[model samples]
Target: MMTDTTQSRGRVEIDDVVIRFKGKQGTVTALERTSHVLEPGTFTSLIGPSGCGKSTLMNAIAGFVTPAEGALRLDGKPITGPSPEVGVIFQQYALFPWFTALNNVRFGLKQFGLSKREEIDRARAALDEVGLAAHADKYPQQLSGGMKQRVAIARTFAVEPKVLLMDEPFGALDAQTRLVMHDLLLGIWRKHKATVLFVTHDVDEALLLSDHVQVMSQAPGRLIRHYHLTQERPRALSRSGNELLEIRDEILGLLHPKTMLADTL
Candidate 1:
């Protein structure tokens, strides 16, 4: 386990998390004794090469997958199984094809046993926050890739989860749209300030969206390095190119350890 001598209001502590999936060919280890503490309300991005098990780690936190060894904690309590306090926004839209944008968010709220009017108001407000209020009546089929993601975001926000987990939310969008979505995400995060863990394979995207960009290794995913963004919050995605590019190079170097220089300079 990584020694974290610090504490935060919304602490997420993982200790000796090991995960393996049995397969016909052989047993595939997704992670090996992974451990890290996420500070309260911090934006953390998990970035690594493909098949590095970023999504697997996320599922563990969301309680979708159980670790073969070790444990996970939220606010000092061990987490087991799915918790309503955590919201998982999948890589795909994950929206009901027949439901309108408003209903999609409303459905999430309703699942929590909220009143009908309360659900509608909260859902409407979330959609408005994502600038999708005008399209509230539209179904997933009518929305664009970015719009569909906006619906998913609105749905997740309406329920007000303690931790928002996103896996490659913008991977399907075009380059320009992806940048725009990144800025939109920053705006929402600034307003809510919830603990967010985003998983992606894009180095620059990780740097652009995270306060801490954690890069994992190939298989049996493990943290190889963490790039801290001490610059500023509310950073512009379009403007962080140079600094993010340098960080991207650093992550790439770590991905190929044989080519990497000494860890500390």
Candidate 2:
């Protein structure tokens, strides 16, 4: 597709952000003074145990959640709320079942006040980029799980958002499909070069996909560990061997120390 690479401008700053929620029982601290800088056009992944606040932190970046303390900024401006500049993709392919793939993507462009022709053209190009141009007329029910996710991705990228926030997008797919999605995602990512913050529970997935992986500690999540991947890109799942395995084990141990200990025993 014909993405305007110049539109990409994602740079994020999380400064000592602390998120707390007042529940019926008590105030639960979801995140505690967690901070990280997401460089523009870089891919960052967040990984940790179930209750660890990875998703909470991602929501804060997406402007869906407010921090109890500190701040969040994109390119030096405070994030007040959700904007077209930041796009979010969740695990569920939230495409409209009634709409065709092309129209679904076009729906997102309507907010930009594009002409009818412009919207159609852009949407078509986005679907083309994801290798789904031929399926433009198909509805969600006509597509497979992976195809639906691609349409979802195409919809997000169609707007050319500066930042992309993803929550377990591939978690629903089978292992084979997940690997294929991984490659497809990386290809689209390199073309767009938007700042990406991806949240996942899979350590190997984090290692395979991100430029840097931030591991949050158990509940009341903190930035417990950071892994910077040195391997070159265009990496395949099969190519992820020794170094990635070692890092995966290290992250696994961090996320599941008690389990690792029991296994060693």
Candidate 3:
């Protein structure tokens, strides 16, 4: 249940953002003049082929990479560096092997200036939210891949960030675990109403979870298309309806025009 205050907090504005990297040869462009707005509390997914700079663009938003050309703003403030208002979940679980699940989550809360008792309480609550309270004492090696990712997610969300940047957070999970995670994530997002920018290479995953799906071009990536999904939530991956299939085909065509053309012929 999102209140008015939380609903109005996480609007993200990307203004003419360009990213580049320096190499031995010269400077290589990663993202080219990309601009878009992620409305408050909405779920947006970035999808493109490999080497399209999907992760690069997301890193800029996370304040891990600085844009060469433009600025990224959140709630009307410029993003100069990582802030507690923005939380990131990476493809790797990224949990500290030495720490137990409870401590891993508590470690993130320590930076927020909470008392030790408060940190413990929040960490416990976060683990409970991710259904890992029973395994709070378990180390990273003791947990499954999905459980480890859940710990990472719990740590991020424990900070109560206004925006969430997830870079293929479920990529390492098994198919069944991924499906379960999708549902769990949606539930948490609905409860907290944080604006989300998810990066994924899987078209179905993008379509299933996103309120808006953004497709980028290969290499020096540029946003080529934006598709708004009006379908109801708790969506299945079955693509059972004509509308879902049509959107899927259109996105597949964009990713592989030659294959789509051959199939049509």
Candidate 4:
């Protein structure tokens, strides 16, 4: 698996990249001259103040946005557009409300026009992987926040994507639900071994789920700090205590100055 970036025995590079958004006022710089490297198979979490353009970076890598400057590549292939090779999961879950969980997973398989039976079998297996086979027949509205996210995770895995892009997938959940999702995500990541770049504002959430925490600055967003989590995988919430909180506070210390001031006062 991947490890520390500096000690990255195997390095992955992202050359200069810049992204802009058109606003009523004018074009806004969401990211600028941003560049970083990630080790293969590593889980990296992006954290920063709100409106820091974390999601923008995810969109850029997912090929939803064209960078005005530089490019992104993986395994040496330049990323120019969205491909099944990358799977993106957002805070909204993005599961169609009308489709049952099973149908959603099947929808991904059907993209290649697989037989109905094969699709059913694959969807079932993917749901089972996320411990949600029993809920396969349920629709998104019927499930709780955690279950819907589980279905989202199942759908992403069903496609066997090369990478998973997550934008605060658990930010909307309750504390208890968030912890459960953390365990579920780590289990799935360990099993699937897909490269995951998770974006979150929750410092503890990032520390809990990522192999590395990438702290970005506010607009004109760019990496300000990165921490390699040497902690073992499959680590649990109940299992983590003071040390985890320490890491969380360290990240908080590095958050945007305004956020720090707001938190202090």
Instruction: For candidate 2, write residues 1-265 as lDDT tens digits.
Output: 5544443367788998999999999999999997789988899999989988889998998999999999998877799999989999989988999999999999899998988999899999999999999999999999999999999999999998889999999999999999888899999999998899999998778888899999889998999888888788766546855787777778888888878544652
Residue-by-residue lDDT tens digits, candidate 3, 220-258: 899999998988877875644678777888888898866
Ranking by TM-score: 3, 2, 1, 4
**Model 1: per-residue lDDT, tens digit, 4-69?**
434424578889899999999898899988889988889999988888999999999999998889
Which ranges of candidate 2 are over 4 A from the true structure?
A: 1-8, 236-241, 261-265
Which lDDT value does model 2 have at 219? 95
Q: Say which prediction, candidate 1 or candidate 4, comes out ahead on TM-score.
A: 1
Please give the distance, in angstroms, between residue 81's alpha carbon in candidate 2 and its true position after superposition: 0.8
Sort by lDDT, top down from the best: 3, 2, 1, 4
Quantify all predictions' global Cα lDDT against the true fold.
Answer: 0.85, 0.89, 0.90, 0.83
- In angstroms, the error of model 4 at 96 is 1.2
* Per-model TM against the reference: 0.89, 0.92, 0.94, 0.89
Q: Which candidate's lDDT is highest?
A: 3
TM-score of 4: 0.89
Going through the candidates in the order shown, the clash numbers are: 0, 0, 0, 0
Summed over model 4, clashes come to 0
RMSD of each: 4.9, 3.8, 3.1, 4.4
